[model samples]
Target: MQARHFKETYSELLSLTDSVPERVWTGILIAGCLALPWVVGSYSLSFATLSLVMIVGVLGLNLLTGVCGLISLGHAGFMAVGAYGAGIAAADYGLSILPSMLIGGLIAAASSLLVGIPSLRLKGLYLAITTLAFTVISTHVILNTPEITRGSTGLFLPEPNFFGYELNTPQKYYLFCLATCVLFVLATLNIMRSRVGRAFIAIREQDIAAEMMGINLRRYKLLAFAISAFYTGVSGALFAYHIRYINVDTFGLTLSIEALGMIIVGGLGSIAGAIIGAIFMTLLPEAVRMFFELFATQLNGLFATRALELRGLIYGAIIILILRFQPEGLIKIWRECRRIWGNWPFRY
Candidate 1:
């Protein structure tokens, strides 16, 4: 009786998910995203902006790791190319924010192509090692290349504006970031459902088999890097403008690994996962740090000493726990709940 009941419930869950049209699901997501800023507090909304920046990065990482089956241990370098590129354009040339962002993204993409072309021929660990080397080299190049990057001192950027209005306030910047995140996520979702997405998945599942099935390995591989870098670069560029400044130290291996971790924790090959993961990772650190500081007086030495170390310890512990269970990530849990609720009237 128990086995029969479990099978019936599982069948009902599957049936409900399939019942909802894709268009409807997309509409609901769009509406929810649009409503976030209005519904959340200002501080929370600002963190949402930070998540927005992270979201763009994770989406790109997803393309490389989730779809293309390639790993980039040094994507932070690409992001640096983009951030500095955009920062330079606005600071030096007096270009508008949008144009500066475009130039920055272009610079990152071009650099990525240079790295991808020769290095992509290698697979798995070899590819990762090559990118990691590029990352280390990129950091030194930016720090020492004074003619362009300006060394340890960070560069300040002009406030972003459209015509008359400058996006100078936290609220205004949040709105801008929110809109961009939505558009990019939509674009990502659309891509994964299209022809290029199919090619990417083919490469991911089995590159040799994909090549045998008429997919050009080199062409698609480079294309993935180009696309991924452009997204990360543009976001990096946007991040420079949004934050009001940038520096060589801003782009580091820690950020590169965190970007990868966001996708991993969020769930690979899932757009919803990318978003949820970014939000989780972005907010968790902030919340923990703030909580410790806010209660330091009341908690005394118990919470005050070595708080930063505690934050890292907690984060590492959570990662291990998440991997042990809920390996598909937080989004999968949300979807499961939705499925059960959506079919409550007739649970088999």
Candidate 2:
């Protein structure tokens, strides 16, 4: 009876919007997001738009690698598929940005099956290699297929429009990206509380145990890949629209690694972690560059060149420190802070 009561209490704690303070904070954040475009300049708005797109992409990856224990190093390739898919539709079919992006997501989802099926039999590092190979091959295909993907020359896309309104300016497009990010993040949170989410957690912890409990390993694993691909693909489509150009080189292996780093630094299997990581990783490099520009005179000119070269090394050091000290990521730190505040006036 005590165990049953404990389980119920624990479940209540896991409720998505249970706490009044949390709900209040969420509302405030939403209001701020809605008002941000009016106050921010174009460059900041553009940066925020890119951050939102990355947040969506990272959430999808968290579902796969974080929740389902699927290791993939080919995420950028999937994004490329999405970008090209939407670009082709918008260019060739005269479709609007909204519908074309959806089509791009669908195309990427379908393509994921090709990799998912073969790699299902493999686990861990082997599976990672399979996905890596897929990314490499996908890039080559994009580069060689000049007829379809425009090859090395790249494809230019018109500014995205919706309901007859053009979203050419960064401020206008910020709203579009913001809406999509909010919707997708909410969807991902709901999904993490559902039966499918439970199954994913099970698989991640112990696949054999999950199979014994009647979970279909094959189906769910592929589903993870497909859904992750869909999210990434949509981000790619948005990227194409945002950049107004598409090239095979844009979504490279480095981009895939960055996505992985987001999940790692944010927290595996955590939706909040994905968002936090995406924001941090996205802004960190830009902040560094800006700092260099601002301090170019105070620091030697040689420092600027070295800073650019050492960015990767600094990024690596940060990740290592996080993993070494707080492997659970920023979400854990955030939770700890919340817990401490909640326990104020009482020493545990």
Candidate 3:
């Protein structure tokens, strides 16, 4: 009876959304996203749109590292592959942005299999190093093959269009990214409620234990890698369109490190964490820049230059502070807030 009760509880926890409140709140959030572009200024709209892109990419990383317990350092390489793939397809082959993005995602997924098969077998530092090598190799190939990618000179992307409509304005592009983000988020939510998601969690907790329960370790790990790569690739394609430019330096080790930081700061194994982390990281640099701009006049020129140079230092400091104070991340703070309000009039 106890075992049955525990099983029932576990199953209930596995559902995508269990309460009417959750559904209602989700609806409200989606509605807000739909209405945001009409009210915000062009600059704010663009920032928000880019934030949504980062959310999608970080979500993919969450699935792999957070949920599946796979350490990857080559995600930027996958994004580069997607960005370049879409760029080539749209510029050279005259394909629409949507189809080009899909092609990019598919190509990235296929490429993941090549890396995942051999690398997934390794764990910890070995896996990380292997993926890092992939990044290096990818960068070298793109730089050497200048005829196709335009090499270090960079490649310009055409504006994205949908069914004969061009998304030239910031507002229109916001809507496009907003809609795409919603679709991907909903798809990820459903996946997290499915058997595959459970398999990922089990593997994250203990691969040996998961395999003992008859889960195919290699198969699921590769699937996780492929799926994660697909999401990141799609984001990359959109990024190329968003920035209208692509270069070998654009998707480098630092971007990969930032993606990892987004997941870590958000909270592993939680979708909300991924979203929160994306927003936080996306806005942080802007915040820093604004601070410098506001105070640059107050400081000496050399001091001002040093302040700007402290960009890396500032970012590292913030991450360290967050890890030290809230290792579980901002998601835990969110949960606490909900718990406090959800049980209003009663003290915990």
Off by over 4 Å in 1: 1-42, 290-299, 345-348
Q: List the residue pairs that clash in candidate 3.
A: none
lDDT of 3 at 213: 100
Arrange candidates by TM-score, highest first: which order? Answer: 2, 3, 1
How well is each residue in 197-241 modelled by candidate 3, as lDDT tens digits? 999999999999999999999999999999999999999998999
Ranked candidates (lDDT, high to low): 2, 3, 1
Worst lDDT run of 10 residues, candidate 2, spans 1-10
Angstrom error of the Cα, residue 141, model 2: value is: 1.6
Clash pairs detected, candidate 2: none
Query: What local lDDT does model 3 show for residue 219?
Result: 94
Clashes of each: 0, 0, 0
Query: Ten residues in a row with the worst lDDT in model 1?
Result: 1-10
Clashing pairs in 1: none
Error of 3 at 58 (Å): 1.1
Runs in model 3 deviating more than 4 A are 1-15, 300-303
TM-score of each: 0.88, 0.94, 0.93
Better of 2 and 3 by lDDT: 2
